[model samples]
Target: MGLDSTPSRYRRIVEEHFTALYGSAFGRLGQVLAVDAAPDGRRAAVLGEIRSAWRDRPDAVLHLVDLDTGATTRLGDGGDVCPQWSPDGTRIAVATGGAARLVDPDTGAGTPAPPVPGVVEYLQWAPDGRQLLLGVHRPAATGGDAAPVVTGTGADEGARGLWIWDTATASVRQLTVTGAVWEASWCGADRIAAIVSDRPTENSWYTATLTLIEVAGGQRIGYRSDRQLALPTGAPDGSAVAFVECWCSDRGVVAGALKLLDPATGTVSDVDTRGVDVTDLRWPNSLWYAGIREPETAVGVVSGTGVDGDPARPAPASTEVAPAAGSRAGEEIWSGTDTIGQFYPAVAPLPGGRFVAVHSSYARPPELAVFDRAAEPRTVLAAGHDGEHRVRDRAGTLSYVDWSAPDGLRIGGFLARPAGTGPHPLVLHVHGGPVLAFRNRWQLGHPLIGLLVAHGYAVLSANPRGSTGRGREYVDRVVGDMGGADAGDLLAGVDAMIERGVTEPGRIGVTGHSYGGFMSCWLVGAHPGRFAAAVAASSVTDWYVQHFASEIGWFDVAFLGATPDTPGGPHFTRSPLSLAHRVRTPTLLFAGADDTGVPPVQSTEFATALAESGTPVEHVRYPNEGHVTRGQRAILDQHARTLDWFARHLPTG
Candidate 1:
């Protein structure tokens, strides 16, 4: 049963193994999307979706899990949005279609709230639970010879705005007459603070306004700023509001500040975060809880007792608290160590010194974990079962590794290797979201890593300079220099891996999707002799074409710092297609046929270029897919093609 002896049979065996492993892993960890802890923190309402079979689509459902007993009670079908737990913990509100529904966590009974005008985006319970803040979308007004215009601030595409649902009166009132409301929180019984944008563009973060509105009179007071403001959390006592303010350049948020705003006077003061990338702001009590992503992801807390200082006072000294052992008066509660990755781990402060969160690692699936001062994480809901154990038994071992780049910047990544000895054929897998990091979560998006390792290949997934786990400065490094330092950092990581004798020279391959796909194409072209083969899926080839065709075309200007038409700009010089003539490695390109993010034309154009340059290349476009393939058939076919492509180009013994 060697690689060359029975190619089809060998491939079939590999596919079957991968299918079983994927099914087991997928089932073991029910896809927990959002988790909201009860006010008391004794239990949590988990909104998740799971597919029993490959052909089946995931059905959304809510589960009430007892933290102490590990008892999970299914609460009817849920929507594809976050479920809000009432302030008093008596009811849970979820958006379903154009209306909001209230579900009794214990009884599983649902009460339909008053229907809104359009599709419901988000539902937030008022402080007293008498009203629900409904983010909904209304169709754009159209007339003769005019195209329908979509507007609004809802997460979905449309004309989105804010609406108030009065529970007692069973009435709905439009809060904002125009513009899209990004996020809102109740400041008091009669006032609400929200982030609103005049234009409903995808890049609203850079143009939104933070406003305090009187609910009854519709009197609005807003602060005007060019910086991006987000994740606004109102104080429990309604004295102040805190939000994340990001300094925006042509690129995205380069730096951020956790600022406190006085609702009465409209004066904003900085709450010192020591200049870290603070996100997921929550005001549970007198303390402000947020997740800090710089240095590494950890829970950060600051006292809000005196946050509403004098309006004319200079911003107080940095309130940033370092990771400490015990929870003192002003210390932050750091979760576990820096070695593990926690991607936006949700934290809910409990009555005592306890906190509950959904935690996961490279080797661990997400599970409900409770934390305390003892520094030990106790799992309340186990995400693994026999299926998970079976998959883990055959899975490769994962370890964290880091190396200094050419520019003295430290780069980090995770390496997964098979059990056997000697230098192994290596596959350098790149992650997308130039802003997103290669975290320690289960590699559901890149399951091919497991399949390749099972067949005797070392997989190296690196987080280069622009990744988010580091601070904003590190993330902003790739802004105007997308393919420069970041690409060098990746090459340096590969060199370090080979230097450590973990990978065989000249037997290396590369693959990635989205921005990662761009990297894949750039890697093979930039270092023509380095990799034996390349797979670039949903990749951007020419910045000019991508700018006009993609939904996030604005990203081109943000990242490249120039429009496509800019004369002799990096948009053309740094694009992978510019160096396509140098590519010697056999390449495989793929994309979703209907992808609006990185349109399939990206792959088509690159494939055409590679062919014209006499490079061995193959192109695949999955039909009815978007930026990423979703259907089970498409996923399976993609996996098989990828495995078979790698095996053919870089054969293993």
Candidate 2:
């Protein structure tokens, strides 16, 4: 009845969709991580990974694509290698395995540079192509007073620092004596701009410093502000440097402004971004290009001409220019779509006003596209599968929805409803990051959403108060009140769905991973009667345990304002484990055994509590998996188990 609505049928639907989506000719395109357009504008280099199946580990590869010929060639294996194009477009630099190698774009030939002692964390070719900047990871020696190093979490003891590799002589030299360098860009041949943090911790983003380092003399000129600055790129002439200065209050980045740094004077000036959240800035040519996050996430080009207002003072309101056509100040080259499922769109500028980017919507996989200002965005490489598997029979239509929270704040979300639905069972899917938003991109990580919708279920994915793209104020709402108003915001979204008559009462299930998992646990425990089934993956149960075990334990100080050791702290008061006695819903828990983000102990502790309290619960730990599971088999197993758990506990029809 109603398409069987059984676990076996649900499994079949999931398998069919996963196969149709991954087994198609276009599915081989894989996921594009980074793209760099050559100087000539005739070609581009892409770093992407191909996954043959839903449960297979992705094979990372470097691809050289010809814009004029539309031909693509796969280079050698690129395991987590981020390739960068030389200014002249003759060569590319990438760190493959432990070696930094220079690759010829035309021939796909790689020549090994001098090998650094440790793993390369960051790699970029200098402007002159004579040297490469690298961030290396060297393991600490084992001895008395030497702490054991933790690898995957990026918190290894004195393991990571910056270095420079000379391509001309094949020589390597250490730059920084201590501190972990996250990113570095050459200001010129003799200077480099970089973001350095004390330790590579989970919350290091908040503590990273923007510094201009002299390569020849090893002198450091640091920015004055204490705020987090990122993605430092220098002007071609080395006169100025541009970086995203995250204007964060104790609540996180409330505003991200593109700031210009004078290398000679050590003075910083804010680029009039016209109120847009500038996530990234680059000066590839005479004009400075910025990656915008709010008012629609897209790429915009700004004039590099002199600032009209005072450089040291904040621009008056009158000096600000709105993003409009015919304005030399700034203009969006690519505005995003309002449709659900499109996200993280990027653009790389080539020589002659042409750009290469990965374009896709929620219903479509990413395809490499070329954009010319005069013509429509043309697809250079299309991922073959388009919603062919998502027919009315097995898939639902995705739409954007918004509702007002209890505090009168409007919250946004995406809803995917099954075809021929009438008060169908709904699943509230939460997103992690508490800071991240559920954009319109394809849910590669949560493929089960499609399967669930196909089986007569409705899914509501809400971006509660803490989610990004809503500006700084809304994002800061979750700070120091993690489980308070944000939880209420999620419940408000559920109430809105109920009022819309899209969901049936008493048949709702809840699921999320990481921060979303934490929300799922808190939701089921605080409001047990609202949900029938709950699946929390890599969840944070006790803030106390999270503070002690997580590599990002600093998140406790940032989000909760106190550590677990602080007496009468919010760490225990805000934890979902505190309300474990009230949980009545059948809950499923899954986590990676090696997850230093949330830590496996969080799930284990909660599972023990649930079992002792006689609540129906199950916990599964994926061995060798970290905060995000990259292994194919582990991913498939997680989805299958989650789907089965939901099917057994919640009514699908």
Candidate 3:
């Protein structure tokens, strides 16, 4: 065995394989992606189960969960994403493997919808439930399936249009042929609201505009976002349109400012969400929203102050939104730190103010539950009772801690301690996307946090200035600063833990992936001899190389404020590889051979620098993997190597 490898300490990594083989998580239930409520609210269609083999892309199957009895039955055929329940709750439309399929929610029997020219990306049923709107993607020049969009890139890489599929006629017809539509939802049956962009490339999403387009042939501009705009949703009656505007570092993951547009007056009003960034918005009773409210996950109602209340009916002279109690971001119905929604927030709104979602924490495993106004969420489907009970007993203490950074700005993080500890060895777990924040959520179906804690390591997840959850102002602070203040936030957090007698100062280590990986690489070099060991997977070691070769080169311009070709600037000084000469820490690096986002060269460049600096380094590149490590065998090996590496360097027992 390699020096990092230790005796088998934990069970063989089998959760992913178990799910793939038995159709269920081995020690836990399935990870809930999104939930859709039936018409009566007594039943719900839940999307769960992510197999290891399909980790390269997200895949889940639909299931019917009984709210009262807490019983679940999986829908037969697997689905890719965007699961929608028909209005009457009779059928559910799920886009499974690039094809649209309808399954009877009760019987779990499925049938294919009429085929379109392109691959189906999104499925949204009409309000009347007679038809569905499909977001079809067919790259302008690519001749094969949309699957290539995952790895390869070219001009107009993700060009998409809309199609309508009729249930009664069993026929499909084109809806819009005009421009690149990123996201679209029904604005009543005849009209649709969509987020449109001029370019079909990934970076073009940064400057997209929210527009209201008709099914026939008309379009109205709603709002043009300075940052990335997404999730354009319209009211059932087509009275108003709502969408989310945020600075997203990664595609498909969105959460931020909530806005309402009165198409009649062409005026957009900001939705006051009690200061929380809206993640998911649905119009059931009024407007129901789920978002990141810093320390907790909040679900609320947006009511009262209507956006011009049909500003176009009589063409109101003033387009100002009328103010009223609960008119802004609405009222908070339920909130908790442990409740989780995969990407952002996923809730299935019932007929009443209550809703259903998945809940998990350091002590409790994931389970389906119902939430009402100000009441604790009632667990309806507790996963793996025996296994969860054992895990809860072994779970020590999880707390939200904060400390002042070098500049006196208060930085926060979640600290998890194992069974018994006093100054336990610390492992700083950094989250991906310098634009994203680390919140307190259960770590299931993945390595890093959960594995570290079980093996007697205390985890300190720092949410620096760049992370979301904090207001936009806080999020905006990390834009151009990148590795400066954000890095200090983590160092300050480490100091805080040492001062509080929670972790040993000299025994601390660090590990992360993507942006987190970048931090890990930068931290070891910038502060040589600080971290005992470092593991940075799929890391972006050099900004110059990343800006020139990455799929989203614009992301560098947005954060670094300059291109790699720009004489000399942050591109050179901010890169970790430039400082590798001073590094003395033993580091483990990983890269995916097929990762187009960070590219494999990022890790290779840093590995070469480490060897040149005489720093102990081991680099591994996995085939068939992308930016995010998802291959089953790869994840299992990663978990084992990470645990062994940490144990070998920062010894506790």
Candidate 4:
């Protein structure tokens, strides 16, 4: 059968196509950072990473994925990510394993940065590129006293400090001895813009504060924001620094806005963030470039320029929807319908003024396309699922369906039901980054949607508020309001599918990871009569306990509107643990042992609660994993378990 005509066999065909393209299904393009052109602009050297990020394997290698020809050259083994070429483009500096490396782009080799034991982080390169800056977690004093990770952060604890390195000399310089410095950028060879925070102790959150430091003269310039901000990117001209600002609200963490701070003047101004929460901040020019959100994704530009001036000024005229004032805008680039809602969208401008956008989806593998304002986008290099081959034999379709919610918000989902099947057992594949949206990029994996469809099962992945791709308001709609609005949206979607004859009500099964896992637990417990069985991985059941154990402590205060010490509000009302008695569905709970973020306690609690309530529940734990399942074996095991659970309960769709 031809690629476009074959719908029933899409899943198996894609698997074969992907295995032929990339050597393994783990060809996950890790991080795309610091893209620049060669001195002559003949070829652009793009620096990126593809590593076992969640797994943290020793073999993780950062590679330079060529934009023009789709050639990938390994940059050697190291913890390298976020590569920045020198002003001369002779060398590329990157955050390698525990340090940094300055490699030659042509040969894919270079000198390594001095290693710093413990916590190592990515900083930025100077405009000259000769110098690199980074943050190294400073160890506690030796002998009598020692501070642990549980203690959190504190002064005198020798928290993560700033460091400067000379690429040419291979010399290192420690800039600070106390507090934590993150999102560091070199303004010039002599100056730097870095965000600093101090804590009374390593384990304290209330004592944290943000500070902007002028590193050239070692000046401590105290600057404050209404909330926490991260990933500060410098403007093209180096006049301002843009960072993400998050605020706590009754609903939960409402991303306030992207703001620009003038390091010289100590002034802060809000950028128009549109309604979508800014996923990334990039500057092709000082005035504007791009901001990315999931679903209906578009690259928008901000044209106006001024200090503390009203960002609400006249909006730019374009087909794109720019962010609102006090927010950031997306790049002035356009991707295809395939990339719109399927995966994370990334863009890098080639040396010749053209741009390359790379995206990956659950329906397809990673692919890169180039575009310019004057010309249409061209697929310069298609993604190789395995080694370096492109999969042209696989084809699929993407559609958005709306399910009504009681909150009056229209919750939508991306459904990739195979074109050939109908009465198939439907697979309710939930998304991971509950804060993220599922896009329409090329996909290859267990082929959740395609595999199920190929295996005679319909697959539906819904966006239950709190999901990105939509504007900020929509994503925040489920903050402290979890289980409140999104849970309703899930049920509505399931019902809608049943009504459309796309899914069998009794044969439906659900599975999700992270926040989706939490939702799965919530669904089985809150509305047990609907789904026959479920698989919840890295989920949270008791919000009260999870809020404290997870690294995202701030999230608890934000999600619940109050901490555990003073509970009993909207958070508890929405907690699935409180509704344990209502659960009737059989469930399989999966957890990662090392996950302090969601904490294994969540799954344990759900299993305990359900079993005690006279419900059948199975708890499976991975020894060394944290938050997610890695390796083809573990992933396959997870899928197998999911399939087994549903097949045992909801058989014969």
State each model's CA lDDT, in order.
0.70, 0.70, 0.76, 0.59
Number of the top-ranking candidate, with lDDT as the measure: 3
Clashes of each: 8, 7, 3, 50
TM-score of each: 0.87, 0.88, 0.90, 0.81
lDDT of candidate 1 over 348-412, digit per residue (tens): 65655566677765467667777776568888877665655555556688887899999899898
Candidate 2's residue-wise lDDT over 1-653, tens digit each?
A: 11233346445655566656665533344666678778677888887767765545777678888877668888766474768888778898877886788888778788987777788866877767777888787755454556564454543354567788887887889885345666778775678887776665435646777877787656464674555677788755566677776534222223355667777776666555554566545556543453434325555666543233112122222232222222234555555652111233345776545667777655666677887667877878766454543432365777888999898998888888887747888999998877766666664235777778876788898888767666556767887788889988889988889999998679899999888999899998888899999999989999988877676666777777676878878898888999898999999999999887788998998999999999999998888898777786676566667778877899674
Off by over 4 Å in 2: 1-13, 25-28, 52-56, 140-156, 200-205, 224-227, 247-255, 272-275, 286-295, 305-329, 338-343, 386-393
lDDT tens digits by residue: candidate 3, 360-425 = 765666778887664678888766445445455544568889999999998888888887648799
- CA error at residue 137 for candidate 3, angstroms: 1.5
Estimate, for each residue in 383-448, the C-alpha lDDT of model 4 and write its tens digit.
Answer: 454332233223235577777877577777777665564765666767764565665655422344
RMSD, one per candidate, in order: 6.1, 6.0, 4.8, 7.1
The top-ranked prediction according to TM-score is 3
Q: Comparing candidate 2 with candidate 4, which one achieves the higher lDDT?
A: 2
**Least accurate stretch of 10 residues (summed lDDT) in model 3?**
308-317
